[model samples]
Target chain A: MGVTSRGFAVLFLAGFAAQPAFAYKIFVSNEKSNDVTVLDGDTLEVIDTFEVGQRPRGITVANDGNHLLVAVGDDDTVEVYDTETYERLHTLPSGPDPELFVLHPSGNPLYIANEDDNLVTVVDLENRSMIAEIPVGVEPEGMGVSPDGSVIVNTSETTNMAHFIDTESHEIVANVLVDQRPRFAEFKSDGSEVWVSSEIGGTVSVIDPATHEIKHKIEFDIPGLRPEAIQPVGVRITEDMETAFVALGPANRVAVVDPETYEVLDYLLVGQRVWQLGFSPDESLLFSTNGVSNDISVIDVEDREVTKSVQVGEFPWGVVTTPD
Target chain B: MMPARFLLAAAFAVAAGGAAAQEAARLDPDWPCVQRKVPTLTPAAIWTGPAIEEAGDWRDDEEVRELVNLLSQRRVPQDEAEATIESFAEGLPAEERSARLTLLFAGLFDTMNAERSEIIEGIERYARHQKALVETIREQKETVEVSPVGTGSEAEQQLFWNLRIFEERRQSLPYICEVPRLVEQRLFALGRAIGTVVSE
Candidate 1:
C-alpha cells in the first residue's frame, strides 16, 4: 500500500502492535561474572551485557515492563535496571544477604530470601523499604507464591521443609517436610500443588498445596553420576502446568517431567552445574544457566533439545525472560 | 730332704702371705703408689647413655642391623635414625621387644622417603577437598535468589517469601566457605607447630 510519511508511520505502529507479543527478551544473572547477560529469545543470540552489583544471582523482570530486578548477594542489595536502556534504575534495600525473591501478584510488595539471616524480608516496592522480616528455617533457598496469592512457600536447605506463609499476615502457616536439602520450590499454575527439589537428596517432591503433603518423589539414575551430582535446583513449570523442567546441578542436565503423572519423560543434557531455568513468555523456549560452564543453554521446548548454548559471564545462575 | 721341703713350703706360704698383704696394702690409703701398680681407664671410657649403649646392642638384632644398614645406605641423619630406633624400642613390650624393635627399625630405616610421600599425599587430599568445598559455596551464590519482585501487592508478598529463601542461601555461603578455611588454617598452623618440633 502506498502512503505518505505520517501514514507510513501510522501503519508501522499498527503492524508492530498487531504482531503477537509472545516472544520475550531474556536476562541472565551470572553470579561469578557480577553482570547480567541479555539475550534475544527468538534468535538465541546475546543482545547486550550490563555490569551489575557484585555476585548477581536471581533475576526477575518486574511485572511492569519498566525495570529488571536482580539479586546481588555479595552487595547485599537488590538492584533494579531500566529494561529499555538496560541502565541501573534503583536499589531495593533488602535486609542482609538477599538471595532469591518472589513478587506478590499485586506487585507492590517484594518477598526477599535473605540467606545470611535465615529470614525473609518483605519490602514495600513503592516505598522501597522492608516492611517485615519473617523468620524461616536454616538455609532457606528456593521460594514460590501460590497462583491465587493466598499462600507463599519457602524452602530451607538444612531444614528440608517447605514453609507455607500466609501472604496477608506474613507468618508461616504450615511447614511440610520434604527431601533433604530442599533448594527450590515451584507452585503449580493452578495452585493445586507445589514441587520442591532437594540438592543432596537427589529427588523432587511434589506436594499437595492444600494439605501440604508430598504426593510423589521423582528420582534419577545414571551410572557414574553421584546422587550429589543429580542435585536439583531451578524448577520451571510450563504455563499450562503440564510439564516441569528441573535443572540437575553438576549433572549438566535438565529433566523434563509430566507434572500430573510425576513421570520423567527425558533428560536434556546442557552444561556443567546447571543452576537455574527460565522460559520465554510463549513457553516455546527454555533457558538455563550453567554455573560451572558459565553459559546459558537455550532449549527448544517442542523439540526437547538444546538449540543453542550462549557463552555468558563466569558462573551464570538465575535467569528470567523479559517481555519484548 | 725333709728340711728342704719344709723350707720350700714355708717360703711358699710366706710368698702367699706377702701377696695377700700387698693386696690389703693396696686397699689402704697409706699404700705407696710405686709399690702398687693399678691400671686406670680414662673418663672417656665410661658409657655415655642408653642411646650409645643401644647402638652397640643394635648390632645383634636383625631388624636393627637392617635399619642401621639402610640408614647408612640412605644417609639419613644419624640423630633421626637414633630417635626413630629409640621410639620403636620404647613402644615394644619386654617379651617381643627385640623382634618388634628390629622390624620397626628395618622398615623405617630406609623408608624416610616413603613416609614423606605418604604425608604429602594425605595433605594434598585434605587441601583439595577443602578447596573444592570453598569453590562450591563461592559458586553457590549464583544459584541463590537475592532479589525481590516489587510489583503488585500479591506479587510483593510472593517476593517476600522468595527473599526468605534467598537469605537462608546467603547465610549458608559464608559459613560453608569461611568455616572450612578457618578450620584448614588452624590445622595448618598446628601442623607447622608439630613440624618445628620434629625438625628440631
Candidate 2:
C-alpha cells in the first residue's frame, strides 16, 4: 500500500462518493475581520484564512462544491470564490447591503436578502447576472429556500414577517407574520415546517409551510439568563425533520429542540453571541459561529455536547461546509 | 468598618472573569457590545441616493447645516424628521430640490456617522474604565484577605464602592450597546426620507 499521487487522487474521489466522509473544509465568515477562515472538518484545524470583502456575514458553499458565495454587506455584493483553490472568481450583483442569502436547492439562482434595500435580489449564479429584485418587507436579512426549490422565504427583521415567494414567478406568495426582529428562516428538510427565529421577540415561530400559519412558538427560559438575552437568530432542522438546533444569540447557547413536539430538548452552551450554525454533511457534527467570542463551537449531535471550540477571526458571523 | 472576611467575600464576588471574557473576544478588548464593533459606518451602508462627493462643501450652506443638526437629533421622532425633510424639499425650487436633498443627506450622514462613532468610542472607554475598576477591586480583595485585621479598612471601603459601580455599569451596558444601533437606524430612516424627496 505505497502512497502515490494517482492512488491518492482515486482515494480522495472514492472517499467523497462512499461513506467515511472526505476531508471537507469548514468556511467561516468573520464579520469584522473581513475574511473567511477555512478549517479542516475532520481534523478541526485552521487550514487557511483568506481576505474577503468588507463585512462578510452570510456564507455558503455551492451544491457542486465548486464555488463559495459570501454576502459582504458593506460591499453590497455576494463575492464568489473558487472553493478548491481559494481564488476570487467574480461578484454577484447583490442589492445594497446583502446580509444573508440562500441558494436554490439545485444551486442555480442565488436569493439574497438586502437589509438596506428591503428587497431580495435574485442572481443567476452560473451567468453571474441579476435576475430579479423582488420587493420584500423592511430590513430583510434572513433567506431560505425549499428543498424542491419551489418557494423562497425571506424574514424581514423590522417587519417581522416571513415573506414566502414563489421561486418561478419571483413574486411574494404569502406573508406570515411572526414575532419581532425575525432574523433567520429555516425550512425543515421535508418542507413540512418553516422556522423563523426572532432576535428581539426571543421566540422561534414554527409555521406550517402549507397553511402559512403559526404551528408553534418555541421560547427559551434559561434559569440564570435574562429573557431579553435569549434571542434566537439562526436555525437548522435536521434532514429527518425530527430535531432542530436554534442558535440563541447573546445567550451563548444553541437550543436543541424536538421539532415534532416543539419542546426544547436541551441547551448546549457555546461561545458568546452564537449567531449562525452549519452542519457536517453526515449531520454528526454542528458548527456554530460565535460573534462575540470569535470562535466556532463544534457540537456532537448525537451526544448533544460541545466537543471542541476552534478560535478563528474576529466576530465570526456565518459558517458553511463543503459538500464533499 | 467592614470585616476583612466580608470584604474578601465581596471581592471574590466580582465578575472579573465575565468582563475579561467579553473583552478577550474583541480586537479592542474594551468593546463590550455583542454587535460586531464597526468603529465607523461607510456612507454606502445607509446613503444609497447619490455619490456623497456631489454634496461637498455642504457645511458652507448654513441652511443645510441647520437642517442636519435638527434631523440628526435622535430625540426628534422619525416621522417628524421625514415630514421636515419633505417640507424642506417641497419649499425648494424644483431645480434646486435634488442638489439640496443630496446636500441634506451628505450633511446628515456626516453628522450622524460621526456621532455614532463617538458613541462607540465612549462605549469602549466606559468598558476600559470598568475593566480597571475590576482590576482594582481584585487587588483590594487580595489585600483584605492577606492583610492584618483593620489595616485594610480603607482599601476594603474603596473596593466595596468600586464593585457597586462596576455592577451598576455592567447592568447598564446592554442599554448603552443599543445607542449606536439606534443612531444608525435613525440615519437610515433619514437617508431614505431624503431619497424619497429626491425621487419625487
Candidate 3:
C-alpha cells in the first residue's frame, strides 16, 4: 500500500476505536542526563529508561516501526535503538554537532541539522552513511520533511531564513526569510503548508509549502513576557491539520493555534524551559519535555489542559511517540 | 609579623631599584646591553652578614646576572620575565601589589601557548582541589551520620567545627580561582584587543 493509504487506515482505526486503538509510547531524550526515558502513553507512566550517549537532544521513531533514532549531540552521532525491546542496535556517525533531525516519508533518507557547522547533513538510512552536506546559516537547527517527500525545510538560528532543499537533486531550492532564531518546522499532513516557529522573534510564520512564501505571521502578547520568553522551540500539527502546538521555550507554556486561521486559541502553561514536544499515537494527548524542571507535562488535547506532569530525567529536552 | 614586614621592605627596595634601572635605560639606549654583564643588586644579597661582606666574592653569579638582565632591559626576556616578576613582587608597595602580581602573570603568557604545561597544570590543580573538597565534605558528613551517638562529646564538637571550616574553605575556592582566571582571561582579551587595534 502507498504511505498515505497506510496513514489513512491508521487514522480511521484510531477514530473508530473506543479507547485509542494505537498503543501510545512516549520517548524523551534528556540532554544533561544522557539517557532516554520511555513512558507508557495511556498510563502516563515511565515504562523504561535506557542509557544513551552524552547529551541526547532530538529523538524520533523511524518510519519503520522497529527502530528509534536519537541525536547524541555531544557524541556527534545518532544512535538507533530497537523500539520493541528498547535495546541499542547501532549508531550512525553524523556530521559535527548534530542537534535535530527529520526522517523522509520514504524512511530511507534522514536529514540532520548540525548546529556547529551550520549545515544540514543528509544520510541514507539504508546504508547508514552521509550522502550530502548542504551549507546553511549560523546554527542551523529544526528540520521537517514535506509530506510529498520532495522538499526539506531547515531553519538556521542566526540567519533567520527557512531554507528549502529539493530532495531529488539535493540542492537548495529557496531561501525564504522568516524571523530571528527560527526553530522547529512542521508540515501539514497534506503538504499544503509549513509552519516555522521563531523563538526570539516571538512569532510563527506559516508558509506556502509549494511556493516557499510566507502566508501569514502569528504573534503573541503577554505583559512582562518579552519576545525572548516566547521563544518557541517545538512545532507539531494534528493529524487532521486543524490544531498546532508550539512549545515556547522559557515562556513556560505551549501555544495552541488554529492552523487555518493562524489564530492562537489557547496557551497551556507546562513547565520551566519547555523545549521539545510530542503527541500520543492516538493524537489525544500532548507531551512536552520541560528542560529546566526535567519532567514531562501531559496535556489532554480535547480540553487543552495539562492534566499531569511526570518527572523524567535531568534536563529533559526532546520527546517522541512510538507507533503501536 | 617580622617576616612579613621584612619581606615588604625588601619588596619596596626592589621596586625602587627597578624604577632607577628603567630611568637609566631610558637615558642610555645601550644601557641594557651593558647591564647584561652586571650583577643584580638585591637587598637580601647585599645585606648578607658581615662575614659574607668580608669575603667580597659577589661577582658574576648566575642568579644575579640573570636577574640584572631581566630587569635592565626595556622588554624583559620572555624566559626570565616570570622569575624576575616573582622576585620583584616581594618589594612591591601595598597598593601596587596586585598590579605587579598581575604583570608577573602576564609575563608567563608570553612564554606559554594554548594548552601549555603551566596553564594545564594550573587548571588541573584547580580541578583536583575542587574534587578533593567535594569528596572530603561527603566523607565527613558520612562519618557524622555513622559515628556512635556521642553528640555531647568533645570529639563530636571538634568534628562539627572541622566540618564547618572545611565547608567555608570549599565555598571560597571558586572565588579564589576566579581571581586568577579572570586576570588570565583579561590578559588574553588585551592581546586580542591589541590585534584589533593594529588591524584598524
Candidate maximizing TM-score: 2
Docking class of 1: incorrect
On residues A1-324, what C-alpha lDDT tens digit does candidate 1 reach at each position?
456888989999999999767556788888877888888767778889999999887778775767789989888999999987988978998877888999887776888888888998888878798888999999787889998888889998888889999989989989998889998889889888888999988999999988878889999764445555578898989989877899987666899998888888988767666889998878888989987556788888888877667778888888888765
Worst 10 residues of 2 chain A by lDDT: A221-230
Candidate 2 lDDT over A169-270, as tens digits, reads 999989999999999889988888889999999999988889999989998987645687788998998897767899997677899999888899988767
In CAPRI terms, model 2 is classed as incorrect
Identify the runs in model 1 with alpha carbons over 4 angstroms from their true place: A1-23, B1-200
Clashing pairs in 3: B11-B90, B11-B91, B12-B91
**Which of candidates 1 and 3 reaches a greater lDDT?**
3
User: DockQ for the candidate 2 complex?
Assistant: 0.01
* Candidate 1, Cα interface RMSD: 30.0
DockQ of 3: 0.01
Clashes of 2: 0
Work out the TM-score per prediction.
0.61, 0.62, 0.60
